[model samples]
Target: MTFYDRDQELDALRTSFESPECGFYVVYGRRRVGKTALLKEFCADRPHIYFLAAQEAEARQREKFIEKIAEHFDDRVPRIGGWDEAFDYLGEKLATEQLVLVIDEFPYLVAENDSLPSYLQSFIDEQLQNTDSMLVLCGSSISTMESDVLGHESPLYGRRTGQIDLQPFSFQQAREVIGYDIEDAIRSYAVTGGTPMYLTLFDYDLPLGENIRTQMLSPTAVLYNEPEFLLQSELRNPARYMSILEAVATGHTTPNEIAGATGIDSGPLSKYLQTLRRLRLIDRAVPVTASAKQSKRSRYRVADEFLRFWFRFVEPNRSSIEEAPKVVFDGTIEPTLPDHVAPTFEDVCEEVVWEKIRRGELAPYSEVGRWWYGEHEIDIVGLAPDDDRILLAECKWTSDPVGHSVASQLREKAPHVRWGPETREEEFALFSKSGFVDGLADDLTDDWSLIDLTEVDVCLS
Candidate 1:
């Protein structure tokens, strides 16, 4: 069975539910990222009412809500009409103890009635204020839901005492959810992207390659067309979005580069970029020292691992994937996926470094990021904020060990980063796929740290 990875989100909601005064909570996320699951799991043992908002007219939704609300009440109320009529009676129905009323996909209800939010806000401020009830508003369309319900100027604004901007599972959290080792979990994250629903389709017992072939690559697979499904819900022109996503997936970073590769002009592309950024599927990054002048060096990339994988492999070769499943799935996409994801290994290294820091293996650093001047880029740089000292890093994904030359090359580029503070204890750290270089352990004396990703005595348990 698939597991949950949101204990903190759960605990925080429960804590809010314990409030003596009335509490309103807003939970929003992208579809299939487990917003409903997190709330349902939290409300499982509690006395709560769950109502799904459909695209039907307001009268129909009111009837369904009334039906759900009746189950939680001591006496059944047959006919229910209007938001004010339903919530006004909720105060008197459960006056003794706290209860939860979850309106799933709350955005639909508000969309059906422009006055719905003001009506609910007025009810909470007036009638519901005297009750022992928790109002749980949950939705999947994040930006719309938040603006309509959770934003500062919203009718439900400042009403929510507790909120969860529920996120997709991180790569580390995926390890627990799927019961995979660090390396294998990274592969899962790269493909399924920590979405609970998608990861549930992944078979942990199968080899990673087999799992990808069976669940992700085949024509009959659920995720084979998952991107298309999600895009249909989120975009006006999925064809254009797919084109833009493909450019990013195939390593087009800047706005100029994406437009050039797709042959789509930048003016039309900016609107699409806004939508993707709002959905959090992609991100725009600047130099760590981001400024307000709208720098031309800004870059864009697909931020989700699964989407990245889909755009890079599945979308590009959809015809080949559909026609020759085994050949393309196993012989093509499988072999090339790792090379596509090598840089994300730097992401794995970041997590590993943080774990080691928490365990006192590596000293803490304020910032860790890639650094470059013009074209040449360094894999990882950790800086001590106080002293402005930097730890230069080299990551090797091959069997070869990182050696003195890597440290030497980084030092050569160090003058370009050109720190304004005194360089303190120039520490060299190497992350190796197989092991460290010979005698480098002896060469380190005591200042350097060498980490081998393959063989570490640290127990994950």
Candidate 2:
């Protein structure tokens, strides 16, 4: 759909342009995360040359690159013999004219020429550093980009002035693009997972179930093969990764559980898990009260909503879906969808509430995340910015109103958080989809914050 966020990225690029020194920037993220969109927006009014590489022969790509730059300069460029000549022409031109040269899908070019990064490094140090050129390298292959382009051992590691590991849109940004009621917008984000390209495919006019059938469940739909494509493009062995993803989506969160479910040894599984984490596909989480460095109770969860949706619902029932899309959706997908989306709703609420704290609408906090201990759990937790106080919250995604019992439960569990001194202040918040129960709102004091779906939208605004 239309552009929604990235103001920070634009500001950074604008600062780079204003600097008298040459700029070398690196931008990378998973496919369809809006990296190219950000670059295009930043380069819209500048004197720029943009070249998008493909999986083609090196000679063809070189010719295409030359053609793009030549067109931008409005001058004919002679056939370039090698990378040196191409970079030399760019460096020489910047001596007089300020320009932005963006090379998208940079990993494709590196695949074709393994020495491309080194050639680029040599050019940056020997020629471009002293000039006024702004060079931006963009890519979607996380593994290659991190290991070959930004890693410590990389030839160009020290050359980049800045690096952006772009992430998916937050709930607020996704809501802006969906253009629906606050509740429906949250659901839309939960299913589409804030990928801009996928969000465009969903029709807001249709019911959620209908949209699911048309845009995702149908065999001919664009997203039908999305999960497979994402894994195949990034990993060499898609089947193994699929198994790992399926395991995580099905509640196999711990390392031992995942290994048992996938029948893979723990040694090899760790490598695969690391790759998945680096790709931003899954996340390792621990109790909010526990130290990230010292906690041995870590668990892995699917971090992307779309991937989780696919693995949890679609992948498990693929054969049934192919045989009868409507039947499978009605019986299996629809009935279980609420429970499936509940955790995502909690995540969205957490983000919105965090924004409030940042904007001074709520009590400021130093840290926030999910908290759990033994058999007790709290959906959201915010540590006081400068003291020993903590904020605890529970997010409910059901249609039923949150009653006094929910508040009472939170009060009971507040004592178990073990954050600081026993007398530490504990503030509570209750976020609900269907609003608070009768008399429940009246019973709560000013110390409690009650947020419904509508309040979430308003607070975000």
Report every candidate's CA lDDT: 0.77, 0.88
lDDT of 1 by residue, 340-404 (tens): 66766767677766677678877777777666658766677777767656766767766467787
**TM-scores, in order shown?**
0.93, 0.96
Q: Tens-digit lDDT track for model 2 on 75-170?
A: 797779998788777676767788899999999999999999988998899988887779999999987898888999899988889888888888
Q: Which one is best on TM-score? A: 2
TM-score of 2: 0.96
- Model 1 spans with C-alpha error above 4 angstroms: 289-294, 424-426, 454-461
Q: How many clashes does the backbone of model 1 have?
A: 0
